[model samples]
Each structure stands twice: as structure tokens, then as C-alpha cells.
Target: MARPQRFDTNQLLDAAVRLAAAAGPAAVTMSAVATEVGAPSGSVYHRFPRRTALLAEVWLRTVESFQQGYLETIEARADAREAGCAAARQVVAWSRAHPREAALLLYGAQDFARAEWSQEHIQRADRGNRRVHAALASLAAALGADGPQATERAVLAMVDLPLSLVRRHLRAGDPLPAHAEDLAEECTAALLGSLPMAPSVSGSRH
Candidate 1:
């Protein structure tokens, strides 16, 4: 008889993500994950008791991946103004690369998920939002769109428009509509075009 095996949580989680990506979240079950990870069902149960918990974990992991990559993209921008534009473009690109994650997110981020959302998930989302907000704020300032305080409309306008358009492309199994650059430029211009160019902060050497 084979010895009872141990399951690595990371491995389990990784398998769960892949399963969900390939077969949708419904395909993620303890038995399914156990088979995918080559572990016993008992070992899988030792880690995740309920399907909801497992699904949530998978969704959370996807969210973390998105949050990390997203911030990195915006942070790479030379200025907030550029960050805004970059953010829009990055969002489209990210959506294309991770359609499964994006679909999972769209379903789970609805207001109804509040009842089941874990605090860790909430905190992670809040942190991600702050990064997004800050980047948007910076863009607004750079564009001279700041009115008394930060106007997030630019960020909202920029990302939301592109994301929705990209979502359509994913829905029909079609490629992302138009080149990323062309779509990004059109959205950025329409959203941030009104803001004045930031006056050069000359002599303010860090």
C-alpha cells in the first residue's frame, strides 16, 4: 500500500488556479484539485474544507497577481500624467493576457460579494485601489485637472472605457479590438485631453 501523501498548500493553490482558469471556477473541487495536484482527497480536505473557501482563495490569488502587475505598470511611468496613460494601456493588455482572471473578477467584484468577501480580500482590494487612486491623482495633477483636490474622473474615465471595450473583445472570443496603442491613445486623448499641461517644476531638484 502507498504511504498517505502530504499536500503542499502552494501546490494545491496553484492547481486550483489552473483548474479554474481552464474549466471555470465551478470545476474547482477538492477531489478535482487533489487529482490535479496528485494528492489524496483527504489531503485536499485538510487544506480547504469547503468549495466556496477554495474558490475564494483562487480568486484572491488572481486578484493579487493583477494588483501587483498593475502597480508595477503604473509605477514605471515617468510622471503621473504618463501613469494615467500607461494605466489605461496596461489595463487593456492585462485583460488580454488574463481573460480568465478578468472574467472571474468581473463576476466576484459585484456588490453582492460583500457578504462573502474575507477581510484579507477586502484589505488587499483596498490596497490595490489606493495604488490605482494615487496613480490617477498624479495623472490629474500632471494634467492640471486637479480641482481643489484630486479628480479621479480622469482615471475612472481612462481605465473604465478601455476595460469595457476590451471586455467586449473577450466576450465574443475575438482579439482585442484595434491595437492596444491605438485604443489607448484614443481613450487617453478623450479622457485627459482637457487637462492643461503641467507647468515644468523647474529648480525643484530633489
Candidate 2:
């Protein structure tokens, strides 16, 4: 039987994430990841062809993980207000659970050298973004948001506000308080509530 490989892809990526979180993307090197995990450089190279590829994988992995849970929260709720609040709460929950990965995400894609990314990487990022917009649009429709500013308002409530809450704690390297989730949910609800809902034909309340 063939000998099993000493290192797996996840191990390398996890190490890279730690480096990126602690010292930024520039700190994530092939040798550094190998050293971080005590693996041979050849093992790291086997999974990732270049430094850019390694960094890209690190970003893609972290973002996709976050998007998966956020999308699920939105999809499972029929009430737009409830779903929007849940989505906001999910941001804090995911960040608290994955502080290292979440910290890395605070660094913009440009910090990861998006200009050098492969077409596949670019496409994957675009797809994830499109999905987020679609989910937000659905929530906006359900919330009775109408008119030209509807989409913009939905994005601010569902994306910007919640992320700002999480980002404040993550950037400070502080643990999110027990009440942080509740605060995020409340803020999201309030923001969405402030927007004008579509006029009901029968003048029914939302």
C-alpha cells in the first residue's frame, strides 16, 4: 500500500490563515505555512502551486464558509424581517466561532492580490457576491421594500450594519460579548424597520 501523505490541504490552509490573521497576507509564504504546520515544503507545494494560489485558497475558503451559513439562515426563513435579523446574528456567531478566519476576511481582497488571481478565482468570488445580492434582494421584496433605493437600503441593513458590529470586535482582538448577538439582531431590525415598506393595496399592516 502507498504511504499516506503527511500533510493535508486543510492543515496548510489553516496555518496560512493564522499567519494571515496575525501578520497580514504578506506573511503567508509557502515555507512559512510548511513551518507553521511542521510539514515539508514539498508537501505544501503539492497542494498549492504558488504563493498567490495559496493566498487565494485561504481567502476563498474563509469567505465560502461564511457565505454558506449566512445563505442558509436567509433561505430557511419565510419572514423577511426575521430572516434579515437572523442573517445579522449569523455574522456575529460565525465571527466568534472563527475569529482567526474572520480576522483574515477583514483584509480586503486587494490585500490578497486579486489582480494576480486566476480567472477561476475571480469567477468564484463574483459568484459568491451575486448570491449575496440575490438573497438580499429577496429579503427586500419580502419586507415590502420598493422604489429606487430599496436595494441599497436592504444591502446596508443586511450586510453593512451587521458586519460593522462584528468587525469592531474582531479588529480589536476582543471576544464578542454574550450580548453582542442580541445587539446585532436589534440593530438590524431597527434599520430595516426604518425603511418605508411598499404600500399595501388593501392598506394592510406589515
Candidate 3:
């Protein structure tokens, strides 16, 4: 049998993540990743034919990992308000657990040369976005809120707001405060509680 591979794909991607997190996406070149992992450049190319592909894979891997936990947390809650709050808290918790990946997430896909991504990569990104939006819509419906305004509120409560908290501390290279999760949950609860509840309709009398 042939000798086992030395540097696996995850090993290369981990190095890439470290580089991107420390110095931004511009630092995640093929040579850089190879040097970071102490692997031959051919090993990276063997796994990812091009830099664009590597960037796409790294971004997708991080995003999908985040989305999986987030979706699970929100879906597991029976109460709409609780679900929203849980999701917000999850963002803070996850960021605290994975600071390097969190730093990589601070930059938008565009910053990773998304425009040069392949159709498959674009589709993967779109699918993740659609799942997130769908989850937000479900949360809005369950909360008795409808229309675009309600969806916007759900997005703000469950995603944007929590991410903003993560972004601020991560950008400053500061560890998230101990109160981060509590703060996120409280803010989300407050926002969701503000939605105007749909009025109950009564049957007309004869």
C-alpha cells in the first residue's frame, strides 16, 4: 500500500483559518497556508486546485459549522421568543468558543473574493443564506408577527444584533466579556417582546 497522506485537507484549512483570522483574508495565500502548516505547496494544491477554491471551502466550512449549531438551537426551542433569545446567546457562546473562526467571520464573503468563486461555491453560499432566512421567517410567524417588517425584526434579534456584539470585541482583539451571552439573550428578548401581537378574531353573530 502507498504511504498515508501527511497533511490532510483540514490541517491545511486550519492553517488558512489562522492566517485569515490573524491578518485578514489577504494573508491566506497558497504559499502562506503551506508555510503555516509546514506542508508542501503541492499538498494544498492537491486538495484545492486554486486559491479561489480554497477560499471558498474555508469560508463555507466556517459558515456551515456555525449555521448547523445555530439552526439546531433555534429549532429545539418550542417558544418563539425563547428560540430567538437562544439563537442570540448561541452567537456569543460560539464566538467565545472559536475566536479564530469568529475573527474570520467578521469579514464578509466579498472580502474573500467571492466574486471569483465557482458556481458550486455560489450555490453553497446561497443555500446557507436561504436556510438562515427561512429560520428567521419561521420565528417571525411563530411570534405572531408577519410582513417584511417582522422578518427584519427577527433577523435583527436572532442574527445581526448578536453578530454585532461579537464583531466589536473581536475587532478590538479583546475577549468577550463574561456577560456577553446574558447581554445578547436580554437584548433579543427585549426586541422580540416589542413586536405587535396579531389580534385574535371572533366569529360574527347571526
User: lDDT: which candidate is best?
Assistant: 3
Residue 69, candidate 2: Cα error in Å is 0.4
Model 3, C-alpha of 167: deviation from truth (Å): 0.8
Question: What are the per-residue Cα lDDT tens digits for candidate 3 across 1-206?
Answer: 99999999999999999999999999999999999989989999999999999999999999998999999998787767778899999999999998999999999899888999999999999999999878877677777677888778878888999999999999888999999999999999999888864343111100
As for lDDT, the candidate ahead, 2 or 3, is 3
Question: Candidate 3 versus the native: TM-score?
Answer: 0.93
Candidate 2 regions with alpha-carbon error over 4 angstroms: 196-206
Question: lDDT by residue for model 1 over 90-139, one digit each (tens)?
Answer: 77777778777765655554322444667776776678778767755665
lDDT of 1: 0.68
| Candidates arranged by TM-score, highest first | 3, 2, 1
TM-scores of all candidate predictions against the true structure: 0.74, 0.92, 0.93
Residue-pair clashes per candidate, as listed? Answer: 0, 0, 0
Candidate 2 minimal-lDDT segment of 10 residues:
197-206
Residue 81 miss distance in model 3 (angstroms): 0.8
The predicted structure with the larger TM-score, 2 or 3, is 3
Stronger candidate by TM-score (1 vs 3): 3
